[model samples]
Target: MHVRTWADRINNLREINTLRNQIFVGFTLTMILVLVFAGAFIYGEVSVLLKQSAEKHIQQTAIQANGRLDVLLKQIDSLTTQVVTDSYVQKLLLKEAKGMPSNFNERQSLLQIANNYMAYSSGISSLELYTLDNRRLFPLDDSSIKRISMNALTQADEKKGRIAWVGIDPRVSDSVLAIRRINLLDNSYLPGGYLVVHVYREYFNMYESETEKEEKNPFRSRELMLLSDSEGNPIISDLDDEAAKSVLAQTGSTVTLEQESMLAVRQQSKVADWKLVLLMPVEAATEGISVLRTAIFVSIGIAALAFLLLTLPLSTMITRPIQQLMRSMRRARFGGLRVIPDGRNYFRTLEINELNNTYNQMVTHMNELIQVVYEKEITQSRTELKALQAQINPHFLFNTLEAFYWSLEEKEESELAQTILAMSGLFRYVIGSAADNDERVTIRDELEHAQRYLQIMKMRLIDRLHWFIEADEQLLQVPIPKLIIQPLVENAILHGVESRISPGSVTIRVFSAKPGFATIAVIDDGVGMDGEALNKLMQSIEGVPSQEPKKGAGVAMSNVQRRLKLYYPNTNERGSGLQIDSKAGAGTTVSFDITIPPEGDGLS
Candidate 1:
């Protein structure tokens, strides 16, 4: 009977598992289908937005290009007008009308003037004069004047004194040469000769570059072409030769260029019959529409997926308190300790809710215990720090007194005695005993302390050093950080002045730096650091880690930096900041600016 009962139980358990597996599989397939559709929709929408942004950007770029092109056209027109009305051209026309001898010198002079102008303007390729009376055209050459047939000029109407920019010559050349006619008469106005200047292609290229700079967008590529006539036969093109020819064949008010689906807008040149064609790729021109299509598809796919895969399961899981507890616990490892929600009857699972309630109660009790321990530890740390400070105070006081005692005992009479007294006073100020005294001590007192330190160092070095302290009397009483000058002096003596063979001198100068600041510099003439060593020294002064400390020196310098930070925390602009200037073989200068805070404001 027991064996039969166990078999029945096994069969029931298998059935339950099979049902759960079927439900999970069905749910997964539904979620995946929804996600796929949603993804497509979101992708479509994003594509649309991107294309629209691109189109707007291109349109603005095009407008800027057009403006620049307009400016270039105006400049060209002005240059042409100046050339036409030039005095040299008028003199040549007058001389030709007077039936004067065909003087070679006079002709040569006129050619030189034209050549000079052409050289100055880099745009003019050639200058020609058409004499109506002679029915001849004179082309200016480097050394001689050549006469050519005036057939092209005969077609030009001079009766109205109208200036004409002729269309591009199909057979003779690819350049667009224009003519301006002036009437010449003796005392009475009559039709005279015409002067023509051929513009170089480089002129147009410069204008194109200027326009491109003004536009400043890289994605939208642009092509500029100058057509020979209004009918659009190519004269010059920024595009490939084949593309230009194909585009010319499709000439219209707005033609779509062949080979590539690009939109071309025709702009008639103001000074000539040539047409300026602006072509933009069709993909670029209608980017907005394409992007919209893509974005719509992507957005729809995302929305569907979110509803199926994310919303349904998340909603069910969120309602379960035990599941919420598990998630919160995982988050706590990353420092996100949060309260777990209480489960209601509406929740899908009752057992999970009961589990969550038990876990929350346990967590609450543990949190109170942790908080008490954390507070106690912090209190203990503060107590220990106070004890350390107390120990440091007495030790420093003992050292200062011992130094003072030795100075008196050794019979160091003059400056040495004064320096020791200053050292004692400085120690008193630092230890809080001198709080009732002037918070702002004289620069003179600071220098005395530095001098004292130097005296002690001189004892060690046996008079191998000299120091100069120079300051204006007015600056002596300006407030400064206590002991600031001493360390800098010590640094120079130990690292700089002492390192040299010859007797070296250290100079301390205090001067006005800028408004609200004063300058203090320690300069030493000794073997200076190389660039790399100087850099390391600067890093240490700025409190950046350096290899020098591991090699075991620079402790005093590091301590100085720490004390500066503690006393003048707000004064340092960016943390760990200091400046040092030095060159190898040349000495180093260490300088810092001190801004005296208002009276009784303390170091910062």
Candidate 2:
């Protein structure tokens, strides 16, 4: 056995010539495509939406970080400017500028001012005052001195007493600095000293900690935040070295580290001239998309199942009645005529209902036509039998005249008169029946007609002829076809008795063998037939035309057989039409049975 592939199964379905299969295939495929397309469309739209949300969240976080950083830097700028511009702090810087070695009291006074500013601002970690020659002026202990870089001094000197905010200082890596020059209080502006304020990284963390405390925190645990210098060197970052490098190398607002794409939003701090960047991994940002995809798949599956369930009833509603109609049509094709009852009300579709109604009408009309044709055929067969009898008139006339001659020679005037009267009665009955439209007559009347013909035959055969008719009184009034018994009796005389040298007798039997049925037979003990002749005789009687026609018992038997069949079309006593029993040199018996119709039933 070979397993069938889906393609093969689909092809088999296509090969099935049915409305249901076709509908199922068409709708199933359409539903599948719709579900797939809908899933893809939903997934695509959700993916874009998730990506946009990640971008927006990251950009907002960067902007918030920048705003807070600017606030911190401004507060530091205010505190440092107060310390640098203080009159006493400026006087001590002037002494240092005039080549006077500052005394302990003077250094202590500058220390006191610096300490005051540090106490006022928590973001200020330390404040260092430097001479124009890069000497540590305030807190003048040589061991505790922090010499400012020429780069910081030159940048401050160019600003001319204005504050210059810088990223994390190289010498003090943990802190960001705000540098400014203190100018002498003279008409000629000259650099008195340099003020260096170190704002610790803890200041930035304090702002970040506040953000994390909010309910909808943009800087979640999965995110990486970085604060970089103008030259793209990171001053403060939560990223490792490799991740920080990836963030700083960004050309656009997105970056990738460790093969995972991240949403990177960078903003430049207005006061500090630093870049604040937020990095959010795509997986963390769009975590809900995975769940959305699962929901989409599940929804599609449910829709498919629902559609399948609906298709069964949908196809059934249309195809069930059609299948029933098809079976009825098949039966009708085989001659079983019937109408679908209440067909119009049985179906949902108007077209199918109309078709069913049309089928019923056609069957009814066909039955009518069949009945008409059946009647015409029966009438035509009876007319043909009458015509056959007419063609035998001269033969019958010659036989009757020969019987009269025999009666004159063998009998006196009274017997001769009886013979002539018998001939006249036979002629009258045969002629009267030929013109009659009704083919059926009572068994008693048919026997009387047969007796007339037999009386004539008795006069002709004399000692060689013998006849007997045993008819039940109850069956005598049962209607059978006209000339039914007479033909069998005549065939018995012609084939069985006439050729025999010994005296032979013909017996006519009319009796009820069972309830509702009557059997009629004409039997003769004379020269009989073999199986071959009997077979031919039976075949001819059954309407199988002979190749070589002859004047034999078969012709008369066929006429009687046809009339019996047409009259009692539904009769099948043993078998239909006639039953003939014979053997070579034995005897012959031709008989039939008729169903007794109810009183007042004219089975026309």
Candidate 3:
């Protein structure tokens, strides 16, 4: 049931076009393609390796089988040599028909000789002698087909010298037989008799028993057979037509029997011309490969399952987030803006979550832009209104002050007229300008403004008030903030010299103090305040803005400090703001540094 359900789901997937389905299908198809190519490669490689291994194993078996057969056959051949050279056998074979003993006597003599040699024989168990006149002149036992085999052996043209070699014959029953001719001592016309040795076939059978015991294979069986190379011979075998034809034509290493579904490995006998062939079924030859095939099937299934299990969920994790992002984009295309589905822990990857955060921030910034535009419109309206008022006020104030100055001048009130003119210029210079306090002015402008204010105050106390202004001509053109020096000079006149009886001297100095900077100091030689007053002034400059008049005696000085901070702004590193030093009845000095050799762009 589960298998059927999986099959149904797989069949249904071909009809769907969704992202997740597409991703799953593409990944599955790719894995299947790789596995299919790999399986074909593995199949070919494994089959070739097994077949070559089978051939090598059969070659070794042929060698080993031939070795055992050769050792026994060699021993039998050696025995034949020893028997032929024996004096007793020679005497029995050379005896003429007239001089030959009676049958009983001959039997006794031959038996004695045969027994002597047979005692030491390795494979042969019987020896028989035949005379030219008799079919059997032997003291040994023979098989029932003696007459037929003797005639066959006697007529064989393979006879050489007084003796000759024979092979494992097909006609005779499971034995090797040889014949020897006895020649006259001095003549060559006729031989006296023949000697025949019969070797039992039990030695060959012993090899089969050993081969079976050593190899206990039950999957397939093998058989060993010896076949003569003679024509018109009768022998049965499992060899198919191709193998049989090759073995008959010549010796070879291996042949496949298609008809019998078998394989043959052949070895030619060195002792004779016979052929030894080892037959094995094709089914048995591939038995090991069948087992490997089963294992490969199991492994393939396991590997496929493992591959899907490990990668499927991971691919979905990656593709799922991308799919969700696409859906959000699709919604955003229709609507104004749509937020992607997201939370703090929305994604397993921190990078994905960060992307979500940046997208959200972009949206937030986009929404804030609307309010920013409205605020900008209101600010623009107020700036225009202020611009209109600024255009009218300074002109009216300057004209009215000019009229008062001329009236005072016509009455010979030159000092008073000068004061009015200076005041008028101060008002017009400050109010008529569009530049703010933070904007840059030349040192020449700031110093001249301070001098005008001092000149106005000097008229009130002509005897006690004295002042000096000193500045480097080159430093005069450097940028400074407007009204900064004038306010400090005003504070010194009212607060430093207001109660002093001695002629007080106020000095304004400007000069380069370090690389890329210039200092401006205002000094008043009046009765200086105590430590408490100086500390309060310092606190007010530090932005405390003290409300008590006694502790906050420096509203103008504090304002100057704030302006310095706004203009210079490096309080911690460069000591740019106001520095104050005072002693009772001695003096008070307020000094500050501004960046010099200005970039000239200034604070526009």
Q: Model 2, 1-604: lDDT tens per residue?
A: 2456877888877769589877887897899899999899989998999889888877777787788888877888788778877888777778777889787777777777788778988878888887766577666765322445567667777778888866677777788866888887752667787787788876875234645545456447677788877767777788776678776886776677788887788788887667888888888888889999999889989999999999978887888888888888888777678898664444479888888889889989998999999999999988998788667554477567667756776766767777787776676666653455466778898999899888889888998889999998978888877778888888888888887998999999988877888889899997788998888888788879877655774788888888777766656536668888999989988888888889877434
In model 1, the runs with Cα more than 4 Å from the true position are: 1-76, 134-162, 169-174, 185-187, 206-216, 220-228, 240-242, 249-258, 284-303, 310-345, 348-604
- Of candidate 3, the 10-residue stretch with the lowest lDDT total is 228-237
Better of 1 and 3 by lDDT: 3
- Arranged by lDDT with the best first, the candidates are 2, 3, 1
List the candidate 3 regions with Cα displacement exceeding 4 Å. Answer: 1-15, 36-40, 95-107, 121-125, 131-136, 139-174, 180-193, 206-259, 338-342, 345-604
What are the lDDT figures for the candidates, one per model? 0.63, 0.79, 0.69
lDDT score at residue 128, model 2, on the 0-100 scale: 82
Q: Write the per-residue lDDT of candidate 3 for residues 189-277, one digit (tens) a residue.
A: 35666666667655454244445745864432454443543341213334544556654554344444444555567777676555666
lDDT of 1 by residue, 1-604 (tens): 9999999999988865643344555676776666666666666676667656654554455455455555555565566556556676666677777765445566667676776666656666777766656433345333221232244354345324544555454335646555666665442546567666566554554234545845854443444544444445555567676777767677553455555666566555554555566666757655666656566666656766655565555545544454456678998898735667653556446676667777778788778888999999999998998888666554577576767767775885655665566556556555554334544466777887787677666766767888888887767777665666777787788778768988899998888756655667889998888988877776776668875563333556666666656655544454432346788888878776666655666322
RMSD list, candidates in order: 27.0, 25.2, 15.5
Global CA lDDT computed for model 1: 0.63
Candidates' TM-scores? 0.39, 0.55, 0.48
Native-structure RMSD, model 3 = 15.5
